[model samples]
Target: MNYQTFQPHPDLEALIKCYWTLEVPAEPAATKQRILPDGCIEMIFILGDDVKRYTSGEEYILQPRAMLLGQISEPFFVEPTGVVSSFAIRFYPYSFANFTTTPVKDLANRETPIRLLFEEKLAADLEHAIVNAADTQERIRIMDDFFLQRLKEEIVIDSILKSTIDTLLSAGGSATTSSLLKGEVSKRRQLERKFSKQVGLSPKQLGRIIRLQTALKILLNQPDESLTSIAYESQYYDQSHFIKDFREFTGVNPKEFYGNDELALSSLIYT
Candidate 1:
């Protein structure tokens, strides 16, 4: 397996984490891989064979050549179809709402074709460009061009929502909704309604995820640091609270996670 990631354009840096590509050679035997939630959404274009996401023994559906996986709230299994090649854009939880009218929160635990959320022509063209790209560099360039163009075509974002997200992210989720809203309680409520309608998750949920992100980075970077210190730095109420939230998001305690080989790839991504 080979995986590579690239930085997004400056204009998109606030919302987009990175663009990535993955390639795996065909295997003689079938294998399954588990994907854990990381509080982000992704738009994926399959460049080679298909991929299947399973929820236990049942298969959901073979992802189309190009699809957007909404925010995943739970762990899931994926089976690559023979040799697999794919490129994806990882969007910050709030960043995805900037592009489409489709409610992202509604997409939890779902992978749907991009056409469902975007115009058919744009989605088709983007998929074609990705699948035909000569190499990872070319793929990255194509995606950059595509995102820049599509961004220009999107509807104007709500100023309230934009400011709210900016405040939450800047505060590292330590700020309360009331403080973030300040003199706009009604507007804040309206924003949460819109967030749920458009982003598929409430503002509080995204904030929790963002907070977890910060905690993970600290834990990974300062392996020798005590959990109590990490909890305080991460703004959790206490060590127990920190551990509970960490386990909720990652399905493992910090100590166990540090030693899990299967989690190594995911740890690298999040940390």
Candidate 2:
């Protein structure tokens, strides 16, 4: 397996987190890999063989070749049908809304083909460019051109939404929503509505995902640390709370997650 991430063009740094690529050889026997939510949206292009995303016990669906993967509230599993090659753009929770009018909430928990989000011709051209690009660098240039064209339209991101996400990120997701609104009940309701339309996940859910990411990095970097210590460092209420959130988003306890083969892909992204 090979995974790498590249920084986005400086002009797009505020909205795009990074561009990433993954390549893996086909394995005769493959286990379902669990994907955890990381409080962001992604535009993905599958450049190799197909992959399956399980919808339920023993049920699955083929992910779109070019699609937008929205904010996921829970963990899901995917398995490759053959060699895996993919290129993707990770968008910050509040940034994806700047490019499309589709209500972000409508995209949650599923994959929507690019055609559904953008005009068919535009989506097809983007996918063709991605698939035919000579290499990763070429792909990056293609993406930069595509997004930069849209960025020129100068879509204005809502100030309230941006500030809320900024506060959540700066605090490592420990900031309370009420505190962000300064105990203003009306503002809290308005924020919730905007978060649904623009960020998909409610502020509270996004916060938990952000916090989980911090804990995951600690676990990956400090393998010897106890769960209690990690919980303290991550600002969870206690060890049990940390374990519960871990299980909720990762589908396994911390002990099981460590050294687990199925988590290699996820570990690479977080590490």
Superposed Cα deviation of residue 179, candidate 2 (Å): 1.4
Superposition error at 268 for model 1 (Å): 2.0
Candidate 2 Cα deviation (angstroms), residue 241: 1.1
Tell me the spans in candidate 1 whose CA falls farther than 4 Å from its real position: 24-34, 57-61, 79-84
Query: lDDT of candidate 2 vs native?
Result: 0.92
TM, every model: 0.84, 0.97
In candidate 2, stretches whose alpha carbon ends up further than 4 angstroms from where it belongs are: none
Q: What is the lDDT of candidate 1?
A: 0.78
The C-alpha lDDT values of all candidates are: 0.78, 0.92
Q: Candidate 1's residue-wise lDDT over 1-271, tens digit each?
A: 6778899878878768899877779887756665776667899888878888776577457877788888876566677778888888998766777788776767888888888887889777777777787887888788778778878877456666767777777877777777877867777778788777656777777778778778888988899999999999999899998899878877788788785755655665655
Q: Could you tell me which 10 consecutive residues in candidate 2 have the lowest summed lDDT? A: 153-162
